[model samples]
Target: MAWWKLHKRDKPGGPAAGGAVLASAAIITRDQVRSVVGRRQEWQAQGWDFYRTVPELKSGIRWAANGLSRARLYVGRIDPDGSSAPVPVDAQGGDMSPAMVANLLAPLEDLAGGQLGQSEMLRRLSVHLDIPGESYLVGFDDPASGERRWLVCSPSEVTSTGSGGTIRVQLPDSQSARIELSIDDCTLIRLWRPDDEYGYLPDSPLQGLQDPLRELQGLTAHVLATVDSRLKGAGIGLMSDDVTPASPQQSDGPNPIHSDPVTASLIDAASASLKNRDSAAALVPLLLRVPGSVEDKFKWFDFAAQLDEHLLPLRESATKRLAIGLDTPPEALTGMADVNHWTGWLVSDTGITMHIEPKLGLICDALTTQYFRAAWEALGIPDPENWACWYDTSDLKQRPNRAPEAAEAHARGAISDAAYLRELGFSSEDMPDEEEQRRRLLIQLATTNAQLAPAALEALGVQLPDVGQAIATDAVRAPVEISRAEPAIEAPPRNEPPALPIAASAVLDDGWRMACLDLAARRALARAGNWLLSRSGRSRRGELGHVPVHEVHMHVSPDQADLAQMLDGAYRDFHAATPGETDLHAAVDLYVRRLLLTGIAHERGLLAGHLAAAGCDRAAA
Candidate 1:
């Protein structure tokens, strides 16, 4: 499987015996080399086609043909040097699309006579090359659909015109007369077998392979003969010096088992028992009796092991010769390669490189120059001369085992996500769409920004609402220092006399709590009012209970507590006096400070019990 070159032809370098440096043209001349096929002298009408006569030739041709048939053909462009690129082709007078061309090349429906698809078409060409050494493909433009159609015309149905550069084809329908087509109108693909100019029909590959084919056939016959001789006792013989006639009378004293009927009968019964049952269980011994006056012997005629002596090397040489004639690997023809997995793969890779690529290049180039370019122009494509037909042979090539390597490349960013998926044999369509990916990105960004919102607001001289001291510290800590401004506008003057101030010694412990509660209540009201101003159009947080901070004080009638009524009246009047003082940022700062103080006081077990009973609970506030 290492694809070793078995034999090399001798080079022309030495001088002849007469001291003349003779040059030979046998290998180069078409007539001299073409004589090797011997088809001109071979008998016809024997129904012995070239491919069917040679089994190895059949397999090799079929293998190469199937590989070419599966090739992916597309509308493309090719350079004069034979390099190719993909190009767009219009279908049915529509915009540039491969639909029309691809369908024409690989149709879902058969083209004609059940042989129109790419695979079938290529197969027919392969068979022709094997049998007749030439293939022809005819193309026509369908006027109705404005598309080009092609069919593989059997080589047998086509006969060349002598000295005219044209071929006549027998139509499939017998009612139609034979139609002559110019060589320019059809694509001709053939191997490099030498032939004449008029016919251009190279002899079949089988012609060159005659020596090997005959050798293989002879070996096969010997093998069958050996098997038959071993299986049917054909090689057994009896040696006797004289012929003796059978007598009706038995001998008087003793007789041979063959001469005595009773003795022969008893011996036949014992032989039957030995054969029908186990020899050990039957307890029968095989015996042979001969007359004393005569000598007889039985011998096994093992016709010399000539078959075994020559079978191996002859088979190998024959296969090698066939491979050489067909330009194929011997392993491909014989399937007797002693190679490990790696070596076998190397040989397969070499086959693609050495055999398949070159053959495909020839076939594709012919199709491109003859059919594809003209078809493209008919579809209204500009600059159609540059375009060509291309076949992608990746499917025919054996892919390396590179799953882990592809994964590593993706992880290293050496390949894109889509490319990685393709390498892993997955479709990129299974991944999320662009819009869905963008939405997910936005949500992630918003969540991250929201978590850092407090710091952002603080940097701009704003603050957040405080749930409690512990909760506030857990959520976000306020800046160590902040600039504060005193209230700029004073309350409007009242019509009543001002109350006298109390001395410091007269202030009670609960008085500080009362002041804190009153401050917290006023700030909360200002914050709510500021929120309503900025977010007027949005829905309010009504389900969160929406209780006011100073609900208890406001609900108490003026007749019950003159002090509470006076404080409420004063704050309400001040709030109404300076409506511009209710800034959201200022209200937020005040609310956070009071809420922290209230939480710390409650933690010290001094405010909670009375706060709820006094109707100033934190939840209500």
Candidate 2:
């Protein structure tokens, strides 16, 4: 499978940037932006160009890293336009990939190994918690007092899906069973109550209030392998139903974007204000490198897309308006043909509210004899034009008159209007010109069917003098009785196709693998003694680019002493912390400290230094 990754600056403006920020801050002497534009030709030299906006992440990515510096955030995952596949299960019901199965069964692992309370485990996982009449919220619980606390799900959880809510649990026997969490109010969020006795209570209050990052969101995922292993060990129903990977999609250079509503919203909305001050903060890197008409079009589409992305999501009523209009009249304004081009207009904006209106909006006219001219078809008559009388739609009436060709087709009738075309590179229209009609027909056919090469002259009624088949072909045998013996099989005795070496074979030696390994190691450290993740693997698991959290753990005693906590605490004090806001500057300080610590680990041979350059520890933390 093909994949891609990016090495972002630890912070926006760093030294290696070679004054990248300074160069980008303004149009400078050095052609930084210009160079990207020029490079467009070079890219065209390599592949076809298509206008595109960046896509959104299909799954919520959880990246965590550690070192002398704080970790940063970025998007990961392909499109989840639809959840088409399920976790795979092998015969005997166990998965061939044990590591994956182990990772998913995290909830069960904590229950079995960490020795945490059922309610506490549920809480730590940020899932629902219950112990008879008394109740507790996930994560919101006080560690010292054991009082109920507000809990949040991790970033990687799937908040909603088609088949109501989903839940999967693993018992001590290693078997995992899928269960549907009762969804009382989907508008809010819903989760399974740990106590079955209260599970069915609609008024239980927590019914529809599902936490975004609940560990249970991944609960069904974790025990998948265990379920398979258990089923296999016990001779359960055979399977692989739930385990296929999603197909990959289009990419651009090092960047790969999924095609989804979010991406469409972002890239399409880019047009409204390609140079807007707010978007400049995050878009400079991407925009400076791409240009041409796409940038222009992105602005208009961006306005409509943002309406659905940012504004629409929070205002519940908009969802209703959108659902109703998606397939009908109002949809034309936001539909592909209009939003994609400048064929639409922003009719109203109360400074707060914006209304988009389509040019050739929608078709609503009824056809009639009056809509056509007399002698509309005289066998070899010109195709009828001027269908204006037939349609009564305001959109069609208001459509901008452009594309001379589309307009040319408007009024030409039985009498060719050749007299009207001398200035348009054509002889007079209304002339009984056969060649002109054929050429026009050719263009019409090509536009209607982009495939199929232009029809040969002979095929056209115009008729070529003489031409034969373009290529030769041979017939093949067919029709065989099922009872007849199969064709005799023969084996090749010696000759075989020559082997070819991959274009690039040093990929494994490169630091990408190590970067991924370090990512996994840091995650393992974060969840140490936690159930989900399996026991440590061979040296392979802790290979290059890996700043294993295990290194820090080795220095800790029985207690889980996180170096990330220490660095976070130090930065938190240095920078002011609001009650709940994510401190941006503090994040920078933490990443810097993390880098130093990780760099030190590499020097001491306790961790791999090569991974430090790639920010593996930071990404996973």
Candidate 3:
């Protein structure tokens, strides 16, 4: 006989060859298995009850679940050297293509015969995990359709067999048949337990929270009872010794004349009448006839004053305790009245880091091992152990304002362009290419230099090519040229005509002239202060001559046509002489521009006195 046949055949008077063999008898008793299962069932029942009835607990779980369900699911490849974090499977330099990764994740979109989507499935799984401290996801090939289907099973619907890594789920059908699934078909995500020797049963998060939950429920009941008593209690009292006797004609049967029977009948009639009326009856006035009673006749008893003043504080404390027990932020369960925008973001971050992330990690690990790896192998993918399903929580985390920091870092060359954009909550895909970034930088640099004084440009060895036309076309094609040049001092012309007195000009009214001069003086002071601060060792040689002269040009640019027209109307006759300037508009524009620059230099203590003093001296001459 062949060796295989000999191994398969049963030996005479001995155990069968194909049967499972054990070295010794089972050490764990059947009673122990039953005890574990019973304890888990009990915890599950309590968790479901509290989750359904307790508002605080429900709110905490809902916050966590809703936030987690919004996260995106992706496949990431583990780094072999462990030098950095895992990268997405479709990322650059990765072996897998986008099409391949999509194929692997296609089943997640159509789970449970299209009855459940990825988000809904995640929500259900999160809810079950938080409640019972364990959740189940079962996958199997459908016999009729020949396609895989996944189902999220509730804790109450699934039971562990505790022997061979197997579980039984009771289907909710007419037959209620129990289906047995092995480790290959089901994944169980559970909280870590230090006492679980076999690792078959894990503890629930709600295990030690029974006292707080019970206290919350008790406090709620007490509040309801207190309010109920106040609403149904007496509001007023009438005390009198005189009683009115009933006449024989008014009484159809036996009539009582004592105060006790009369008072009882009267109270019953009032209570019945009030009960039949709307809530507005509480505001109505009550009149009672007590003859010969002047002292201590009517007294108001405040039943509402008997309510416990400390009830609200007690309930708030209980709710906070429940939130603490569940490892959630108190603000999430209660209200966000105490939280500001930044603190709210911090709370969300802390909640995800401390509570939600760990739970999601456990779930993703289970899914990767039980389902994703097998599916990838079936698709003939190599090295299945290198890739796993993961979640991206970027959506759940709120991005803070970091524009200033990002800009400073980029200007200092401390980080790359991609890193700076990412700090501002932008992805690398949104970043422009190197050539485009260089073109934009050049354009911005030229524009900024065009606003500087001519002496400043010459001192800095920079030149511009038609900035106005360049900006209008939104393009820069000419290469910038720089060369060394000797500084020359040019004396002011002695016979130049005095600048037209802007304050006394007839072209504009007093208000317009004053406004224009005031605006120019203010702009000059600000520009001179900024320019003086920007001076460095390389540009100090021409510091005195480098005063900015283009304040009016900025207001007259293409984007500021209205301001340009206003300036033209305000300074039509002002003449400040400039080299090679002939047009009246140009002369007036140059005159105003020089006045502003001179004012700026004077304010910085660069010049001896104000521009108005020189203009006045020239006018007197």
* 1-621: candidate 1 lDDT, tens digit per residue: 100010011223424433332121111222322222223325221114545665766788887787767765555544567544454343224544565455334321223223236767766666655555655565433345645445565545656654344556665558465666554333333333335553444655566666677787777778877654333212223344443323234446665456565445444544454455434313422223333332436434432233487678988888888887775666787675477765676777777777666666666666665444434433334675666566566666555667899999989999988777766766556778987786566554333442343454454445544543223333223322211222111112333322212321133234554455445445544443343333333343242226343322222112211222122222444345434433322233333333322221111122222233222343213
* Most TM-score-accurate candidate: 3
Candidate lDDT (C-alpha), each: 0.46, 0.26, 0.53
**lDDT-better candidate, 1 vs 2:** 1
Q: Indicate which candidate wins on lDDT.
A: 3
Summarize candidate 2's per-residue lDDT along 1-621 as a digit string, tens digits. 100001111224457764432111111122221221112122221111110110000010000001001111111121245242222222114422564333323222222123224323222221111101111112212335644222222211212233333222122233342122222210111232223565433121122212211222233233453343322211111123332223234568675554663443344334323344344323322121123354343331111111124333433343233323221233322334435334443311110021111100110011112111111221111332321111111211223334375346646542234423432434333455788777777766533321221362334654322211121000000111111133111112224321212311222233553454444334434443221113334452344224345344322222112333333233333233322222222223233333333221212112233223223233222
> Tens-digit lDDT track for model 3 on 1-621?
311112223333346545442211112223333344324557668889999989888888888788778876777788789785567755646565766766555534434444236676677778877787665555554556756556666756766677655666666554566677554333333223322555666555687789889888888888777665544434544445554422122334475433465454444434544585444324332334365565757655544436578878988888777877774666677777778877777878888888778777877777676556655554545787888777878768875777898899899998888778777777778878887786666655443432322334444455434542333222111101111121111112324433333433323233444344444444533443344334434444254345443332222121211222223334322323222222322222333334332221112111111223223222211
Q: Comparing candidate 2 with candidate 3, which one achieves the higher lDDT?
A: 3
* Candidate 3 similarity to native, TM-score: 0.58
Off by over 4 Å in 1: 1-50, 79-116, 139-150, 160-207, 226-232, 235-308, 334-338, 416-422, 425-621
Error of 3 at 57 (Å): 1.1
